[model samples]
Target: MAAAASPDRAHRLLVVAMDFDFYRQAHSDLTYADIDPAGHYGAAGWREGRDPAPWFSTDAYLEQNPDVAQAGVNPFVHYLRSGYREGRAISRSQFADAYYAALANGDVPITAAERSAAAEHFDARFYQTMNPDLAKVGIDPLDHFLRHGWREGRDPSFEFSVADYLELNPDVSASGVHPFVHYVMTGRHERRPLKLDLTFRQAALGRLQSFEGRLADARRWARPIELTQLGVLAEALANAPARGLHLTFSHDDYSRSVGGSQLCVQREAAEFARLGVNHLHVFPANGWPTVRSGATRTPMGVLLNGETVGSFVPHDITRALKSYHAEGPRSFAIHQMLGHSSRDVVDIVRAAGMNAGYFWLHDMGSLCAGVHLMRNDVESCGAPPPQSAACGVCIYGAARSGQLREHELLFSRLDLTVIAPSQVALDTWREGSDFGAREALVLPHATLVPSDEPPPMRDGPLRIAFPGTPSIHKGWPVFNHLANRFAADPRYEFFHLASKPATGTTARHHHVAVTVDQPLAMRQAMIDLSIDVALVWSLWLETFCFVAYEAAAAGAAVVTSPESGNVAAFAADSGHGLVLRDEQALEALFESGEILQLSRSVRRPGLFDLKFSRLAAELAPA
Candidate 1:
């Protein structure tokens, strides 16, 4: 049992250890309420998990030494009595050593020098805005920074962030000095960097933000594969077909997301079923390759007639391939191979004895691992030579050379035909490399039916919007930047049309969910909002963008960057919108009032049905 001090001695020890300012700041009600902190600690503060000082956490000490808590003794008293002598480990205090050192000796008032330095660097409003709790208190914000704000990792101003400073300079962090004080005193003189370059972080954040919609779909609709039904699925596909089996491979489950490629796959599968062909859509499980523990096997999901039938984790891949092989004539389509093995795909075709294979040019996944050809998840690299310096600097650069080789091997091993959704897409892919495709052709997803509505007449500033999810590759950042620049201007009103609103953006969010069942939702929303322009500033060479079509369908003039592959082509060919060269050109149009004039001359976008089965018979082997 630990040594225990008498009640009188314990009270004396408690008073000695308690930090008045820290206690008052921690419990705002105690400060300025004329209540003695020591008196409160004796009454209820200790029981309420309040720390006695900056150096000592009451709850932490109790948790670390449960015996002290079990005895119902004051933790501060126990610590002062013997716990300190026993060298018991306590929670590492968030405050620096300077705070503990001052608290240990006696009440140390904020030094004049420290206060002046903090005041020079601090923005009281910024600090209070960042920390709303501190704003509610009547305490001087500058005093708070000198005393506790730095300890709490709060930024002193927009220019100076405490966490950023500490992360960049370990010396300051180790010295236990206030970050803003150190920066204003010496960090600036030492030529130390201030704010972190958030370019890469923004790129990563944009990728994650764009993926949110897909994640929601997966959670709501995607189901785990039925592991036990693998054999049954194979047998059913083999026997159910009156003609032959049609196998399609892609990156993820079509049932889990609304994308152009996913919709095409769904349409193709439905058409195959109507033609008396058993269709099996196979993709990597959970949208990525999963390697089992203590084994080299990866799991794959198999969907038949749009329903996931089974999960196959092959311990012996060759043996598993034989189970899926049907004796009848078989044809295959490789829509994407993002999360699957190229060798495995080739093996599957060889094992199933497929006579012909069709490869879809869906965002250049075959050219590079970064499917959108985005270098570092930022700007488009335009499918540059894999050995070029541009590729060397790209995050996907190292994998591009190897991926292209694998894709070539897959194409060489099969009687392959390359199908691009647009002529521009096909030409771009052809320019990138020679894939030894047996045949290459353009097949548009839908044919447009031009609308006959008269040009829209409006009085207020032209309402502009970015259709679909906010993504880096999709040019959400570009749109966001433009919105911020013109936020106060009455020339434009920005809007984001998607299922969810983007964070830290100035655009007014309008919820528009476009699914297989509600394909016209986006178009309808644009019509309702009286949106004059749809900004499709895609950062990559998009294969075929549905947003451009949807915008045109709503009689909104499509404004896009030249990098947007099919969108640019559609705009130029259809005469439904304008294709600006760059951000500067776009800004120039807005400045010159050319955008408003273009809107008045905007041609209506046509509606077209997507029918992959139109070329199905030709794609199949004789």
Candidate 2:
């Protein structure tokens, strides 16, 4: 519908575009020939986004360029006639001016720098005309463009980021809050209900935070409330070893300075019992001393990682555990002859008219003076830990305090049967005790900590964990030795799952807080942190090292000692552990890197099922 152009004419327009570009360069050092002619493109010439339907069209050329258009010279006929008549010559400066004018007319495809200058002039006029804040802020009139002005979009590659834009326009940025947020705060962005106001939003966010805090607090409280009924507890205590077995510990479930023995007993026993496949019961109510009303010392508060969480009276912890699970102990087993007496203790059980007395042991304390006398490592009975005097010191001390002759006279009156887990425990018992375990079933009564998250894959420093109380007897000395010995190595990291909070720190290792308050949290944390290996470095023979099993359950490699008790035997039998002899071997083991492979080979040992079933059979009459 418009004039057509010759090939030669089209070629001439290409040169014209180059001239326009030259002008855009401020006519600085560059010539018309210096710019690429094809840089400005479209169906004809106008601009890239222009319609091609015109096909060399323009306004009535006859009125503006009669001769040039009448000759059918084609594209931009009117412009050619006006700017360059048949005999007239056009200069680059004249063309650059025309191109600049077209940019101001809202045409696209203008040079980027020319476009920016034109946009600034237009933005200032638009802001002055439309914005009310122009007078109050006293900022440059051009500074107010909500999101866009004449230049509504840009190529990201060429545009400056918001931060850079702010850097270049600090005056604009200093005017107020971020522009988008300010629009909302000023109520100019949208109309909203009362709930959307700043005050309401803040209040809602505060409530959400409070809810989360209460949830975490609830998670941190280990004591039971009214959730589970007491009937379950009576059922549990009446028929314990009705399935599984664990003994009374020195502290409640809260003490990591020892272990979560009571928690372990309650949880594992409840599980087996719920399964209804094999029998299960926690010994003497899942804690030590078969806690009667006054069998224990003052119910001490439990301190973990050095924070006092709560306190318990004698047997109150067990009461809570049973209440928590809606379960109770079915029977009572005395662990170690160390912390017992036939009168007040036995009378406490028989007072309930319970005659099924079960004795349990990892040591032959009944035959020897001290329960902790390491094999071939004693001349006379050694002293107990200063914290606890019941380790054969109070009631069964062979040579030091309580005379065995006096104990033997008292022991003849009660009915008791001793139980052992491993051949090692049985053999040691035989060497020291006059009466052997009525049943020797190689089962650690406390099941492994229930598995939660998968272990993390790691490739950096050796991450080692000591997973029991940091008690001197449980091997705090060895832990300190390792910490000091590896102080300078960047390739090793040590973590102690301490009961007490961190009092002080050494640069060698970190103290991880593993508490009874949140067993599942502890398990998940272990997996999350990629704790690599668990050290079974106890100085004494553990009746059953629940710590070793717990660490394995949490996905760490077990590096137990090749010493007495179930810790050594289980580590050896698993074939996935690094059984080192002593502290001297730690570095060598670390350097060996066998733990990396051993970590992958962990297998959960049969917890209390085998031992409990065997005990049940033994308890039955032929």
lDDT of each: 0.72, 0.43
Question: Residue 145 CA error for candidate 2 (Å)?
Answer: 59
Clashes of each: 2, 26
Cα displacement (Å) at residue 438, model 1: 1.2
- Supply candidate 1's per-residue lDDT for 500: 88
- TM-scores, all models, native as reference: 0.65, 0.42
Off by over 4 Å in 1: 1-230, 235-243, 286-296, 314-329, 452-458, 591-593, 600-622
Model 1, span 1-622: residue lDDT tens:
5767776676677777788877876664454455767777866888988877877878889888888899988888777778878998776444436555545644325568867876876766556645666545457777666665666666676677678788899898787766777778788999887767665337475554333354356557645654544556556565564566778888888988777788778777766766677777777776641211222245677777677666775433334446664455567899887666666776666666664789998778888877887777777778888889998877676667766877877777787889988888898899887888999988776655655554345568878999998977888877886775566567788899999888645678899987656767887888888788999989889898887887877778889988898999899998878898888898887777677765533433343322223434346643
Best by TM-score: 1
